[model samples]
Target: MTFDVKKEEKQFYSAKGPELIKIPSMDFMAIRGTGNPNDEGGAYQRAVQTLYAVAYTIRMSEKAGISLPGYEPYVVSPLEGLWWQDGYAGVDLNKKSDFQWWSMIRLPRFASHEILDWAKNTAAEKKKIDTSDIQWFTYDEGLVVQAMHHGPYATEPETVSEMNDFVSDHELKEDFSTRYHHEVYLSDPRKIAPEKMKTILRHPVKK
Candidate 1:
């Protein structure tokens, strides 16, 4: 059976309403870019492509005769992002051009720095795109409040507002000092209607 993070770790991916939870440290294959995500063939789009290329390379390593110690077959985690802007408290949906994003996909436990380097080189060779900027890093997102947002990306502010209310009710404060506003894409916009799309909106919080 294939290991699926969504099913295995339901709490992290599936949120019906705003709730507080603790997240542990996890490894990620990440790429950073600044620009409007809607720009055609732009930096954000290219960064996403690079991330997938490397992720798939690591996923299919066994088929390619690449050895990974203690490897297990699993489904790729959903695309996640850390979004923010300089001198801004939270994201401004209207001003996407000034957005700084860290687009990332979670890696399995077996993935290591050495394996990531190999995957980057192999993906670059296969996809004919520069993957040198892709970086391997670990993130520890401690306490957070998250909810499943239902609707288009542009409408996330509504959900964010609700989350903030919950935060205040619980006597917690949003701490963007060492963390960020995070999002996990659970549905592909290409296949799902904007009104029906699902996204997990998360923000770091502290008491």
Candidate 2:
């Protein structure tokens, strides 16, 4: 049955706002996006291309009536993504000279195997490369708290700080079992304008 995953009711925590609580360790497929440092335009375009490429593949597969176990797509990014940390997440922004940007699509842990199979093949075909261009992994099952950021990413620290406080108040500690701080992009400030930008910041938390 077709349903709106975005609208799907999920356990949530709200203090300053409603924080969507997603279980960690959901399997996901991602592209290691890199972009031109100076060519913000090119970087953005490429980022959009990569995001749509995978999203379309999943959507088309579902439309064609393909079924498998576990299914959902999340556009994952970093927590302090806008900052440049030299050899770290900052490297992607360095690619701007080459017209590249870093981004990725995170498939839900419950995403169907058939959907993943199709996504792999589809990415290879569209990007003119094989699996090398894509990286697939899984997120472990745990507590993840998320909320939408509606301003420039530079201003996200405040929002994240509040979210952290909320987690702490609720007796939740940061879950550091994983190496990555998960973020899902719901809006592209480069194109959508910051006033309307929406970024979902998710942190692994221990309840």
Quick one: best TM-score, which candidate?
1
Model 2 lDDT, residue 117, Cα: 66
Clashing pairs in 1: none
For model 1, residues 8-58, the per-residue Cα lDDT tens digits are 999898999999999999889999889999999999888988998999998
Query: Total backbone clashes of model 1?
Result: 0
Instruction: Report clashes for each candidate as comma-separated counts.
Output: 0, 27
CA error at residue 90 for candidate 1, angstroms: 2.2
Per-candidate local distance difference test = 0.92, 0.53
Q: Which stretches of candidate 2 lie over 4 Å from their true place?
A: 10-24, 33-48, 61-103, 106-115, 126-131
Measured by TM-score, how close is model 2 to the native structure?
0.60
Candidate 1 residue 184 Cα shift, in angstroms, is: 0.4
Of the candidates shown, which would achieve the greatest lDDT relative to the real structure? 1
